[model samples]
Target: MTPKAKAATGALTLASAAILGAMHLWEGQRLTVYADKLAGGLPTYCSGRTQPPRPVGSTLTQAECDAIDRQTATEYGRAILACIPAERMDQNSFDAMTLFAINVGKTAACNSRAAHLMRDGQRENACRALAYGPDGRPVWSYARGVYVQGLQNRRRYEMNWCLKLATAA
Candidate 1:
């Protein structure tokens, strides 16, 4: 091969390798962050003998939030993951679903239309099926909408980041 042609090919190969390495590093970082966040904020649950933080009718504090977050993240997260046919949720869904689980509790989200579609192995349909607002727009709660739009936004950003990483990987 000509000298110039050989040099150009070598450069391109090196660039591709570098890009792949960067992507791997990025995905690793994101996954670590996701796991760490869940670990740090996960809540504790005791049996009926133990008193719940609120005594069944009170607002939650940081401790309660932590307890609930941890409990739901584990219980609901596992249940949702099990129902999902995919071996993994592609990080975006992991963070999204876990956060959603933490907020609305497992039973609520697990029983949702989105959950059913997801379990049925309908990803595109499930994504479209998720509703976070009222009157057909993102809202604050379930009085009208699905009530988890904010976390859905978080999932969007996470998925975009993953895609960018994929291109490089």
Candidate 2:
């Protein structure tokens, strides 16, 4: 990898810890697999992971959950950094974005207005985009067409974290 790429990777690695911590707090730990009715009954377990589908009764140890969470966060962080210049993001912003991507999906986060703003060097606006869209309404704050306070809260948290270094911007 080029020096720049290596630097980005190192930065992401440092940010991953904060991302995982936030994810654990937000997603919560479920030892047993459960059907997420809001997500069309997707089988989810271990920090909201739905991949490698397990039966509803499947269980995992704390160690397994931590490992999965780290792996998933790392994957999402790398994908996000691929689209937004890692050099443009501070640790708080990177952590917030990574957590948002984990919740909303890499493709959505990467294509979001926030990503556009970040790529355009509008760091503060990019952070604000996570909570409010172009129409000045909360984005990604719905589930099954119903407004969810939890999602709104999550967005607010991310937006705050993303803006932590904005004064320096």
Q: 146 in model 2: Cα distance from truth in Å?
A: 1.4
lDDT of 1 by residue, 39-97 (tens): 24322222111123223232445454444434433454455555554333444444445
Q: By TM-score, how accurate is candidate 2?
A: 0.90
Best by TM-score: 2
lDDT agreement of model 2 with the native: 0.85
lDDT of each: 0.40, 0.85
Residues 1-169 of candidate 2 have per-residue lDDT tens digits of 3567567575545335678779889998889999987788999998889888999988999999988888788788888888888888877888888888989999999999998898888989999999998888999899989989889999999999999973442
In angstroms, the error of model 2 at 133 is 1.5
- Looking at model 2, report the run of 10 residues with the lowest lDDT sum: 8-17
* Residue 56 accuracy (lDDT) in model 1: 28
* Candidate No. with top lDDT: 2
Stretches of model 1 off by over 4 angstroms after superposition? 1-51, 54-72, 86-88, 132-140, 143-169
Provide the lowest-lDDT 10-residue window in model 1.
27-36
